[model samples]
Target: MNPTIQLEQQYLVHAYNRAPFVFTDGEGVWLQDDAGNRYLDLVAGIAVNALGYGDAELVQVMQAAASKPLHYSNLYHSQPMAQLAARLVQVTPFAERIHFQNSGTECNEAAIKFARKWARSHFGEGKTDIIAFSGAFHGRTMGALAATPRPKYQDPFRPLMPGVRLAEFNDPDSLAATIDDHVCAVIVEPVQGEGGIHPATPAFMSALRELCHRHNALLILDEVQCGVGRTGTFWAHETYGIMPDILCAAKPLAAGLPIGAVLTSGRVAEAIHPGDHGTTFAGGPFVTAVANVVVERVSQPAFLRHVSETGAYFQEKLQEINSPHIIEVRGKGLMLGVQLDMPTAPIIQAGYQHGLLLLNAGADVLRLIPPLIISRDEVDIAVERLTAILTKSA
Candidate 1:
């Protein structure tokens, strides 16, 4: 066994089932293991390393922020936080306010709280139910977890918060049946990330918007893994042409730095007064400064165009592989899934051996969330390695 892996096992909690390899460093689309073996990082740290590893610009920003102060309480205003909030509101359509958090879970938690508060103030306490879809993953926190519908993630911690309903993703009938006047909000992912990279159909999203509006319920979109140019657009919901009342984003927002944000429409923004919710590390100057840079680069039209082109190229190549083991190929932009006839664990192991890193969304789907900035050559390399692994496994 590698010395680093041994050391990690000795000290760290056994919560994660990590790969055997220990990565020492990375640059662009490649990660170097402790033994000096390099692999193409198609997973991109589970889509958090948006600019790829060792991004000089992001590193410099972190260093500069480090030189000054590390963190400050949310009570105080910071230039970076202000700037990032302004930039986010400006770039996203219909978003007027921003509340920062430290992770995607925290952002979702805030959104849930905001929804309840908005509902209670306008309608009453009874109108606090939140409708979330099956196979959704919001976060581990009690509030966010309550909004997540998967039984496996929630069964262990039974008696989650009340008034949380589960609807079917991309099924308007299920949503319409569950969401009603009592429901405060309906949260969904434009493209389900951990749920096998399933893109929500246009009609489904459009119906959700109408239903939410008609019922006076806020619509929240969890774009933690699919946003930040991963879906060839700044936000995955943009493809559906539906704007969410509350948007939760994180993961790659800061290109690996821990930062999350909840952007709310003007109507929802007006509902939450000061002190309704707060986080100690929300919008810390250092993290927000890095996020500003990431947002600037990712929101560029040219960069997003490149993401679209590369994503189309990636899907095309994956389809061309046409292996019998491949059950289906689906997704948008760099956020894709190759659903296999067999469990994805062995294929992932094979990919690791073939100098490639990938992610398993569930039992049967291999998720490909490469960096939006990945070059054409890198995509081709990833596809070739994946094809070889799939062929051998079949």
Candidate 2:
């Protein structure tokens, strides 16, 4: 057994069943294990490494940030944080302010709190209900979990945060039936990442915006996995031609550093005041400094165009594979999912032997969210490896 694996099994909580090999080094889109085996990375740190590993500009910023003081609590202002916020608001037209958190869950929690506060300040009491869709993954925190609506995840922790109603994803009629005057917010992911990579229809997204406007409910888009150019756009919701009142983002924000942000419209921002919500380590100078570079690079027009072109080519390659196990291919840009006729656990395990890193979205959906910088040549190689794996599995 690997010494590191043994140590992890003995010391760490059994919350995660990690892969056996220990990755010691990474460059571009490949990761090297302790035995010096390189794997073609298709997961991209679960869609967090948009620029891939060892990014030159990111490394430069990291070195500069490391030399300076890393943290100063939210009580004091920080240049990097302020600058990053300005950049984010500049790109996000509907947003007027930004709030920082440590992860996607924290962003969702803050959005929920802000929505509730906004509702109470305007509509008075009893307008606190929130509507979340089926196959939605906001986060794992208590408040975010309530809106996630998965029995396996939610059943374990029952009596979740109250006033959360469930509606069918991509079914605008169901949403209309479920939402009422009591609902303060409607939260949905433009592309459902963990729920098998289902993208919301433009019609559904439009209805959500219209319904929220009609009922005075805030629209919160959880773009944690699909944002930051993963979906060929800076934000996934941009494709829908509508804007969210509050947007939750993380994962690729700092290129793997622990960071999350909640961008809010002027109305939503007005509800949050000093001391209403905060974190001790969030928006630190170090992470924000690194994040500034990430945002600047990933949001570039040429960079985004590359993601779109590469994603289209990759999708075509996937469709060409003559595998009976492949049921369907869905999702936009590089954030793709392959629905399979069989369970994905064995295939994922087999990928290790073939020197490929893969991930499963749900039970049978093979998720392929490679680095945005991956080339067409790399896509061909990945497809060849995937074909072999699926052939043997079949």
Candidate 3:
């Protein structure tokens, strides 16, 4: 057994089904393991690395902030948090107020609480029910977990949070049927990253927006995986011609640093008071300083346009592979998936053997969420390797 693997099994919890090889370092779209073997990385740390690895500017900012003060309590307002909030406001039309946390789960957790609180204040306690999509993956915390509709994930932790319901993704009618005056918020992922790459259509999003308005329910868009330029837009909902009352952003916001934030309107912010929600090590200078760089760069028109064009190009190449097992190719921007007729375990294992790192969205969908900065040549390399593997198996 690999020494690192042995050590992990001996000491850590058996929560993750980790890959075989242990990566030592990475730069751009490539990663090197301990044994001096390098692999082309397409997973991009599960979409938390928007700028790939070892970006000089990102590193410098993080280091500079670390030198100043690594961490302090939320009791005191920090410069990095203020600057990061300002940057988010400038880049995104939302961000009237923000509640920062340490991960995607925390962001969704905050969103849930905020929505419930708002409902309690505005429409009484009866309006505390929350609605989420069938394939949505907001987070793993109990509150967010209840919003997640997967039975396999929910059965063990049965009876999670009360008043949580599910609606079908991209189905405005389903949303209409499920949400009512009792519902406080409708949380959804613009693109379902973990449950397979499914993009919500404009009609569905627009209808959802209208329905939320009709029922006085907040539309909470969970962009934890697709936000921060992953969808070639600042926010995935931007393409649908509607803005969310509450938006959850994380993953690539700080480019691999653990940071997540809930962006909400002033009205929603008014619902929660000082002690409603809080966190430590969130919005700290080190991570927020790095986030400052990522937000400014990824929010630029040129960078976003490149992501759009490159994503389209990558999608075209995948379609052109013409593999028999590949049922479909779907998703937007760098957040894509190849749906296969068979389970994806073997293919993903083969990807590692072929000097490529890939991820699976469940059993049958091969998620290809690479860094936004990955170039055309890198895309071709990943495509060629995957095609070889699929064709050989066929």
Candidate 4:
């Protein structure tokens, strides 16, 4: 066995099935393992590294912040947190207030609490249930895990939270039927990331918004993996033209820094009192400062337009490969997936051997969430490598 792998197995908890190779460093679109082998990084730390690895600006900011104050309690106001909140509100359509968390799961927890609080305050204790989509993945915490509808993830931890119902995504009738007066919120992903790169239909999103309004339920969009310019927009819901009442953002928000947030409308913000919810590491200065820089860079109109053009070009190139194993290509902007007729494990392994890194969503969907700053040349390289692997695997 490899020395590093041996050491890791001895010390680390066996929670994740990590790849064999241990990456030593990364720069731009390239990553180098310990043996000096280079691979094109299409996964981008599972869609967290927005500006790619070794971003000088982010490095400088993080280093400077580290030297000063690493972390402080949320009781005291921090400039970075205040600045990031302001920046998020200024860039996004519905960002009345921001509640920070350490990870996407924690952010979802905060959203769930806020939604329930809003419901209880407006419609009494009866309105406490939350409707989540069938293929949605909020997070792994208890509350967020309950919102996640996958049996594989929830079976062991059965009897999660009560009043949580699952509705088929992109199906307006299913969602409408599940939501009622008791449904405090309907949490969904604009583009379902882990449940396969499934983009929500515009009609469905519009209808969901209307339905939420009718039943006085809040609409929460979890953009943990697809937000922050990954889908060529500041917010994935922007493409659907329907604003959510509460939006959860994380992943690339801070360009690989640990940060998560819940952006809510003024109404939802006002509903939650100070004592209702809180986090110690929430809205730390260092992470928020880094996030402020990332937000400003990603929210540029011209940059977003470029992302759209690049995504179209990338998809066109992918289609040109014409691999028989590929069943369909779906998704928007940089967040795409190739649905394979066969299992994706062999193909992903083959891609790894051919100096490419990829991720899988479900059994057959090959997720492609590269850095938003990836260029056409890098896209071409990734496509070539992936096509070769797909051809061989097929």
Name the best candidate (by lDDT). Answer: 2
**Could you give candidate 4's per-residue lDDT for residues 1-394 as a string of tens digits?**
8899999999999999998898899999889999999999889999998889898999899898888787878878799999999889998787789888888988889999999998888888799888988889998878999988888999999879888888999999998778788889999999999999999998999999999999999999899988888889888889787888898989988888788989999999999877889878888888888998899989998888878888888888888887899878888999999988999888878877899999999999999888888899989999989878877774
Error (Å) of candidate 1 at residue 42 is 1.1
Best by TM-score: 2
Q: State how far residue 176 of model 2 sits from its true place (Å).
A: 0.6
lDDT tens digits by residue: candidate 3, 3-56: 999999999999989998889999998999998888998998999889988898
How well does each candidate superpose onto the true structure, as a TM-score? 0.98, 0.99, 0.98, 0.98
lDDT of 4: 0.89
Q: Write the per-residue lDDT of candidate 1 for residues 246-359, one digit (tens) a residue.
A: 999999988887889999998888888888888788798888899999999999999999999999999999999958999889999999999889999999899878999999
Stretches of candidate 2 exceeding 4 Å from the true structure: none
TM-score of 2: 0.99
- In model 1, where do residues sit more than 4 Å from their true spots? none
Displacement of the residue 305 alpha carbon in candidate 2, Å? 0.4
Every candidate's lDDT = 0.90, 0.94, 0.89, 0.89
Model 3 quality (TM-score): 0.98
Instruction: For candidate 2, give the lDDT of residue 153.
Output: 96
Instruction: Give Cα distance to truth, residue 213, candidate 4, Å.
Output: 0.4
How do these models rank on lDDT, best leading? 2, 1, 3, 4
